[model samples]
Target: MDQLHHQSERYGTDYSLAICDVDNFKKYNDIYGHPAGDSALQAVADSLASHGRESDGIYRFGGEEFIFLLPGQTPSGAETRLVRALEAVRNLGIAHSGNPSGTLTLSAGLSAYLPGHRVSSERLLKEADMALYSAKAAGRNRLEVAPEVRHIVRS
Candidate 1:
């Protein structure tokens, strides 16, 4: 919160945020047990951290969801980087403690700024949430840019 005020010039409100949630993770855990679920989440989080920008911050937004902040990036650029990172997640092929190998996938939502629009931090989160819902609706393991920002260049 302090950062938003103190670093206003350094960190413009222009940043975009993308939130990714693991699809069907609850079912996987309930069926496979918590240990496997923990392993999967850890593996995914590690991969995301490695693939993300040095300046971009990632957070565990509760169960099965992680948010990646794309500072100074346009919506399209955010999507592009995200698509690559997400693809990598799809291919991670981590072995489930119960399934032996090759388990789990993610669904992500992307929110970006429009040409003339500015959004508060809370609004930004909501937009990302909507996009995430759309992604899940569209089909799991896919990316959906916010409707308003879809035209923004991907990557």
Candidate 2:
């Protein structure tokens, strides 16, 4: 993330980061064994990876959580791609009776770094994390974007 921030700062490029978490994952693990949970996570990972562009960065943030870095993308553009990725994960048809959707789903929170915003990587991550929390709060399986940092902070 720091490297991406540096690149964006140096090249005056835009980049968005998303923090995605599997909804009802703990319940799924309790219902299905850990092995099944692992498989489900793998499936979700694969689906996310497949939906992203080659230049995008996909990584497992931790158990049941993944992060995506979309370089050269604005918040809205990243949202478009993430919305598709969210649907694709749901369409994977991985059963998760724990989830209200009756299948596995992802909730994502997105934040973007624009040149001249002078935002720190940590702040960007915090913004994304907050958005992710909002997504989960507003019913999972959705994407929420953090308010633009530029508006929140004056250079």
Among all candidates shown, the one with the greatest TM-score: 2
- With a 3 Å backbone cut-off (N, CA, C), the pairs that clash in candidate 1 are 76-153, 80-155
Q: Candidate 2 lDDT (Cα, whole model)?
A: 0.89
Per-candidate RMSD, Å: 3.6, 2.5
Task: Give Cα-based local distance difference scores for all models.
Answer: 0.75, 0.89
Model 1 lDDT tens row, 1-155: 22542353355545678899987787779887889888888989998888878988888889989998877777867878888878778789764333323457777888765445455566667878899999888777788887656644432
Residue 69 C-alpha lDDT in model 2: 90
Candidate 2: which pairs clash?
A: none
Compose the digit string of candidate 2's lDDT tens values, residues 36-60: 9999999999999999899999999
lDDT of 1 at 67: 90
